[model samples]
Target: MAGYIKSPFNYTGGKYKLLDQIMPLFPERIDNFIDLFSGGCNVGINVDAHCKKFIDYNDKLIDLLNVFKNYDLNEILIEIEGTIAMYELSNTSTFGYEYYNSNSSGGLADYNREKYMNLRKYYNNIKDNYDKFHKNVILYILIIYGFNNQIRFNKKGEFNIPVGKRDFNNRIKNNLIQFINKIKSSNCEFINLNFREIEPDYYKNSFIYADPPYLITNASYNEQGGWDEDCEYELYDQLDILSSRGVKFALSNVIENKGAKNEILVKWIYSRNYNIHYIDKNYNNSNYQIKDRSKKTIEVLITNY
Candidate 1:
């Protein structure tokens, strides 16, 4: 936990929050680390491995990581600061949760909305034109200032998430700096490919990790392209193949979430000779404060050692 680096972007369903419980389950010695669905790249970047490869279906995300690896931090920060100033937003100002609530609107809120829309439009244009540096910078800012700190794109492949109450604060800056530094220190490779396309036979002494979108849960990634039953089965099939070939892998998924059970995952895990480690996904301090706290979801880390 001391050196775990946070992903700069606040990705929904990201494994960063579960790292304390998740990290210890990884094999002590990992010659090569493979992240099959590296959404925010939180897992791969943090795992202690000799070398790492981050693969994902989203090309834009890969593009963002490429920008982080290649571009100068100062230049990226310059663009971020410029956008903040242009919006007349404060990095340290306290805007209560009510400001972001659906019911509240007036004064500075209106101005922020207008400014955010303009920035979003500019970002969409940059994305369409594929201007590498500025596009990545704008995207980063959007994550900082977007609703719920999420990065979402509309059906047209445009950045469409509305503005959030927050601004580009220190936490974001530190996370960005930490992410870049981690990339600099570690041997990392980013590839745009789906889970099935990855050939497991190519490497030895490697650990493959899959944090795919849950079939039963709803998320931003799920809406992009539905993670249906077929996709889930395909991933399981791939993992099965890897298991036969002596490839060690770990899969993070939910067994039951909000009364919706992942029957496929439940049945598959029961049938397999794998290690199932239950993860307490809740990070609520209230759970510690109050004696009786109901469990929200059942998260499990399935591993083929």
Candidate 2:
């Protein structure tokens, strides 16, 4: 229910509530704000007015920003609505892969239909997915714009997530226009870039919010074939590097054990840093059972000052 974007698909570690506490932790008077993971884009939109670069690795994510900023919002909806209804047919029918499973009752497959097909179609139409920029905004948008905002795929790169409790394609053009206008007025710049390629100078006295994938044995947020723990360690290494250069940073992650948790690596990673702060919070809508454990956590705010 954010102004423009729908608050980033209810992720496990999304910093929605913690923004108030996390904001004061951010270094004031920075020339710009940089969100490395930028999954739900809370960091970007929350501080969009002060950001110099709202970067992320997801193409569909950037597309949300781009289309909202550059394209006609009303026309985009008209284009999407015509294609969305094709998924409402019988589950066994020959509709596009974007439709519900008729049997996805409560499984994690929340991605079938909605805007993903349009995103792929849009990308394929543009003929630039192979380029260096790899503009795949439509693809990312489809993953989120779908029923559950679930991002999953088999070895063949086919999406197979189930349906959620509601439909997202029902939004009118006016909704998108207001959102687009909100983002357009902000001082925001979307970069389809990853952390490794960022220049060393970008970390100078800026806030780099790190919400990388957890270093765990199981993948949350319904994505299959999770990212490697080594990648997270590598990101932690980069976070430490940023801290050394006087960059202010805040990280949201699981710091306590809920029995089934295996974040020993995350603890090891955070222990290496200085000035870490712990904040208590809940993990609502999470598949984990938090009855025995406190849902609260230490929000690891890493900084030099």
Which parts of model 2 are misplaced by more than 4 Å?
1-8, 85-147, 169-178, 220-226, 260-273, 285-300
lDDT (tens digit, per residue) of candidate 2 on 1-305: 33334343554466766676666676666667777777666656666436557676655556556755675656555444544444331222234234444343442234433334544455545644453223433343444454456655455445455444433432423444455566767777778887778876877756677777765424543255456655666766777777677676776565543344436545755476456566545554332344444332333555445
Q: Which candidate wins on lDDT?
A: 1
Instruction: State the lDDT of candidate 1 residue by residue for 1-305, as single tens digits.
Output: 57789998788888888898888999998999998889998889998888999988888889889888887777777787887877665545344435444222432344467778887887777636676787787778777878877977888889888877666656778888899988978899988987767676754668998999998777898996658899999999888887888989999998876557789998898898788998875544322223443434678999987
Model 2 TM-score on a 0 to 1 scale = 0.68
Off by over 4 Å in 1: 93-111, 283-296
- True-vs-predicted CA distance for residue 19, candidate 1, Å: 1.0
Task: Provide the TM-score for each candidate, comma-separated.
Answer: 0.88, 0.68
